[model samples]
Structures are given as C-alpha cells and as structure tokens.
Target: MTVMTDRPHMTTEEFEDLARIAAQQAEGLRLEFIGGVLRSKAMPDGDHGRVILWLTRICMQHHPDFWLHPGQGIKAEQYREGRAIPDGVLAHEDAFVGQGDWVDPGPILMAVEVTSWDSDTERRDRIERPRAYAQTGIPVYLLIDRLKCQVLVHSDPDGNGYETVRTVPFGKEVKLPDPVGITLHTEPLKDWVR
Candidate 1:
C-alpha cells in the first residue's frame, strides 16, 4: 500500500535540471523527486497559506530561533538522490543560510504539509511526504490534513520510515516531539482549514 515505488524515473541531477527548467517555463510550478518518481506540486490555496501562517506564528512564539519556512526545497531519501519541496520546513533560523536551492535535510527538525484540494493530495501529502522525510531521518513530519480535519505527527524515523505516528483531530491539542517540543492548541486550525 506504499505510495512510492522502488524504481525512480531519473537521476537526481536530471530531475534537478528538469525542475529548474520547469520552474522557468511555468511560474510557481514545483516538481519533486521521491521514491524514484516525479510528482508535481500544485499551488497553495488561501486556506493552505493561512494554515502555514498560523503554524509559523506559533513556532516563532515558542521558539524564536526556529522557523517554519514555507515551500523549502530539501534533499531527501537515500544517498540524497531524492528532492522534495515540503510545504513547511522547520529548522534553525540560519539552517539554510548560503545554501543552494535544495538544501540538506540534516538540520531540518520537521517537515509540514497541509492537504491541498487536488486529486494528488492524498498520495502526495499523506503517503509520499512522510516516507521521504523519514528516509532522510527528519525528526518529525507534521501533516495538517484539511480534508480529514486532523493533524498527524510523525516521528522516530527508523530509516525506512517513521516508527511512531500520532493523530489528533482538529480542535484538540497535540504535542510535537523533541527537537520540536511545542504543544499546539489546534482549535484555531478548525478555522483555517475551511
């Protein structure tokens, strides 16, 4: 039932080159390479932006030194062969400083995705994201599932994937694990997901 297949369509270098050209041809078009497959990311809707804004505020309030950077390109999966543009990448303020377009995921504490209103949201956000982030050993992968009205916190990456996953419905409180020790009062999320 895994979303990612074993075979990749192209090498990381080819994918990166294609991504660059694609971005130039179509403004705001994002491409991701994961599980050896190519996937396109849709543009965010207002609600999606709002959700990220809310999380950014909370992250800054609790950890001023940390940041929830939106649409940050990250090197992912084994041998840094995969690349993904996570909706939000949580890391220290200068984690990506002076880095190229796709930065290393080592300093990233968490990767967040707010479900989009699209056919690919389910596989892209719920399945591909966690697996990619976990395989890169990211400490956490937080998914704010708009359609499901729930938040899934994935942590404890055991290489292949995360070992622990905790889901909390909207309006309930959920604590993100260490490296990102922030307790979120998710009631406001109810407002944003609409």
Candidate 2:
C-alpha cells in the first residue's frame, strides 16, 4: 500500500494496499493504515522506545496469553476511515496476524499510549483519543506521559467516553485492572525519562 504523507497524495485505495505490502516486505518497518494512507511514524527514540518495550514485557509476563502489539495500528472503524496505531495494544484471545487491513472492534482489555513532547498531542492522547476508545467500549486506556513523568489510567468507560478514575505520578503506585489481579510499581521506570 502507498503511504500518503507530506504534500503529495494518492487515492485512498492505493495507500491501503501499499501499507499492507510494507508490513509484509519488511520485518523491522512497522506500517499502519491511517486515513487510507499508510503513515509510517518515526521509530521511537531509544530511551522512550525502551520504556514502551519494558511495559509490554511486564504486561506480557503477567498475562501470558495476550498478544502485545507495539506500534501496530488498530482499525477502529474500517468503513468510516477511522484508525489509530496505539503504542501498546493488547490483543487478547486473538493471536497477532502479521498483515491485516483491519482489526476487530475490541473490548481490548488495555490500550497504552506513550506521549510525545507536544502539549496538543498530550491532550489528544490523554483525553480525545481515549474517549473514542471508551465509546467503543474498550475497558482500559493507559497513558504514560514521559514528558510529564506521570501515568494516567482511564477506566470505567460510560456510553460516551472514558472518565478519569485515577492518576499517579512518577514515584506513586500505578495499578490497572487485569485478569490476574496484579498491581505494578513504577518507580523503576523513572530512569527512562531521558
């Protein structure tokens, strides 16, 4: 599929087909189909990326069955052209398929997003997008804001969107609802700030 970005553009059909090809052709390059164009975002910086890696590892270690997808875009609405590739998305019960045009509308147990430096984006991820996920009935959306050294968990998704149930700072406790009943400690993650 051809990824539409920058000034030059292509028809939506072209981008979707090419994006799938990108994922299949290269193992390292992560491709996501967004707005009918495959948008390949920059690879996360070493420290920031590692933070996401560690978190995925921890989640997988605790929940052995879930498939941990980092940088894989979820097809929130295939027909409507709504899509987002979350930082860390847990596909429970379904094994990871290497290439797919769309993902299931899920009651995804957890969706974790790591924020960038922009204040606008901070609000988008923390509030806007999560609300969309909540409206879709995703149970938990976790935001790890490396810029602010805070972890925000959005829980109890009502009909409209997610409500802020609890939030924790760098040194405080961060516990998310899970199948296995485990509360995690985040002080060790402080080192990834840089």
Candidate 3:
C-alpha cells in the first residue's frame, strides 16, 4: 500500500524541473513523484539493462508496431498529479510524438518495471508503481522482480489497483494478456537475475 502523507513534498511541476536539471548533472539521477512524495530512482545495474533489452526484443518481435521505450516519463495517478518514469513504456511507435517530457497514460499499452538492486526496491517497484499505474488506467503492469525471482503480470485495472495479478516464477512461460498480446519465455530471465 502507498503511504499517503498530509501534504506532498513538492508539486509535480517542481519535481519535473528538478528532475530535468538532475538529468543534465554528472550523476544523472532520476526522480519520481508518486503518492505525493518525491523519490529518487536508483540507477539500473548491468543485469537490469539486460532484462529490459530482453523484454524489448520480444515485444518488438511479437508486435512490430509497438515499441518498448525505456525511461519514458508518464503522468500517473487518478488525478494525473504524479510523475513516474517507468523502466519501459510499451506503446505504438509514434505514441509519444510531439509530447513533452511527461506524456499522458492513455496510449500506454503496458508499464514495465525490472526491479533495481536497491534498498527501496520493495516499496517503490512492488507497491507504488502498480497503484500509480492502475489509478491512471494503464492496461497492464509487468513487474520483473529480481529479488523475488518472479514475474508478476498485473492487469484489469479498477482505479484502486489491478484486479487480476498473475505471478510466475522465472523459467516459466507467462502470457501477457491483450492490449499487450505476447508470451514471454522467461528462461532467459533466469540468467539475467542473481
């Protein structure tokens, strides 16, 4: 569950400005505004990048018209007050054409998150992302949890959260339901995670 506070740390606009400046800095830090809180996202490890690349290849092969855009910012939450840069935002090739840094969630087919080997991965990836994406009515949320060594496919968004959640251990073949019609042979994922 998302921990809501009495007030937000900063407005979405403020977070956006800070995130942009931070991106240009040497550290290349990425920030996310979720559940009325500002959180810094951890940089992905080598294996993390491989996991994303693996998914990207499969998504493109299955649906050539769709693209898995990495580090794409999205306007999230029920009221669109939150900003989250999902690990990969699956959408049509030209879905975000002419959009600003943050794009609306309407055209997003799926939001993918490959867990980072960070202390906060549990709450940020497992808890917060699903809520924010579901509230935004995102059709699917695919969580490749490295720590747990499982792949969770979240679908059937109902504003509160995803109504149907399917979890499959790595090495299993899991089907990502419609809007994102594809089957993942997660055997390769086994090699990517620790």
For TM-score, the strongest prediction is 3
Query: Which stretches of model 1 miss by more than 4 angstroms?
Result: 1-6
Residue lDDT tens for model 2, 11-94:
445656766677689875655444334345445677778878788778778888775577656655224344667777776646
lDDT for model 3: 0.92
Over 114-165, each residue of candidate 3 has an lDDT whose tens digit, in order, gives: 9988899889888999999999999999999989999999999999899999
Model 1, residue 168: what's the lDDT?
96
Ranking by TM-score: 3, 1, 2
- Per-model clash counts, in order, read 1, 5, 0
Q: TM-scores, in order shown?
A: 0.95, 0.73, 0.95
| Candidate 2 deviant stretches above 4 angstroms | 1-42, 77-81, 96-99, 118-120
Q: Write the per-residue lDDT of candidate 1 for residues 76-194, one digit (tens) a residue.
A: 98788889999999999999999988999999999999998899988888887888888899999999999999999999998888999999999999999998999999998888765
**Which stretch of 10 consecutive residues in model 2 shows the poorest summed lDDT?**
33-42
| Full ranking by lDDT | 3, 1, 2
Q: After superposition, how far is residue 189 of candidate 3 from its true place, in Å?
A: 0.7
Clashing pairs in 2: 1-17, 1-18, 1-19, 2-18, 73-85
